[model samples]
Target: MYIPAAFRSDDPDLAWQLVEDIRFGCLISGGLGLMASHLPFMVERGDAVRLVGHVARANPQWKELEASPVLVNFLGPNTHISPSWYTTSPRAPTWNYVAVQVRGRVRVTEDRETLRRMVLDLSALMEPDGSPWEAAKLDIAYIDKLLPGIVGFAIEVDHVDVQLRLSQQNNADDQRKVRAALGAGSLRERQVAETMTRYLGRLPE
Candidate 1:
């Protein structure tokens, strides 16, 4: 990710929060060819950051990942900015948003025990409110039958890049205008805009 100095985010906690908030991420690997997989990820703390996830065994992306550097993209809320919404003269439209990218080496794990543990940990993270579903509640035989169909892996993060482009380059007036336009738009767009407002400290009118 090419982040300008004005839009760069250096807060590790905020970056991790974004990653947790957006569970789905794209795993990109560069090798004989560029391969990518859209998968849900779990973040674990260790000597280095640990990312765990799985993909269908049929997916070819997993085969090319051995000893290769992989990039996982965690995209947060974002909104399209219309040039017409700016207070200044017309300019090209752009996106206002926040995203984090984790670059690391990919390691595939086939151990059934490890896979089962990963699945249970992922469940807990996704349902922290103590949902009805628990790992032990499932039938062991049924769970065992399904384990072979998927491939699990962990990425030991080498570096992380976080970018928050909330119109930091724009003046107060222009940012306010953009925020207003976004907040008045669709629900999803408005939600993202509100987040930007809070993070950038743009007072609501």
Candidate 2:
């Protein structure tokens, strides 16, 4: 992630919030070919940050991980900004966004007990309201039958790159114009615009 100072997000708490908000991530690893898997992840922070997730044991990407490090990308809201929305003279269109990338070594956990715990924790985190569903909802016998089909892994993050480009380079008038235009445009664009509004106050003049 090439983030200029104008678009850098260095706040650790904000970085973790983005990770939690965007639970789904793309896990990429390089080897014989570029391998990628889209998976839901749980962020664990203690002595270090660890990303936990699971995939089908049959996935070829899992087999190739022992040979190299893996990179996980968590993408937040992003939107296209039309040059027409800017207060200044015509400019080339660009994108405004936020994304976090984690680079780490992958370690597969084969232990069924650990995998089961990981699955339960993921479920709880995903449904924090205590809304319905339980780890025990699945028939124990049936779950045992399914457990063998999957494998769990934890990526200990050695490095993280976070980028937040929310029209920070633009003046307040231009930023407001972009936000108002995007907010009324489309669903995705509106969401990004809303995020920009929230973080816009933090940007320097």
Per-candidate TM equals 0.88, 0.92
Q: Mind sharing the TM-score for model 2?
A: 0.92
lDDT of 2 by residue, 14-110 (tens): 7777888889999999965898999999989999988999999989888877678889998989988899998798699999888999899988887
Best by TM-score: 2
Give the count of colliding residue pairs in each prediction: 0, 0
Error of 2 at 157 (Å): 0.5
**Relative to the true structure, how large is the alpha-carbon lDDT of every model?**
0.83, 0.85
lDDT of 1 by residue, 101-164 (tens): 9998878988999988887777667775757877767787887888898899999888999888
lDDT of 1: 0.83
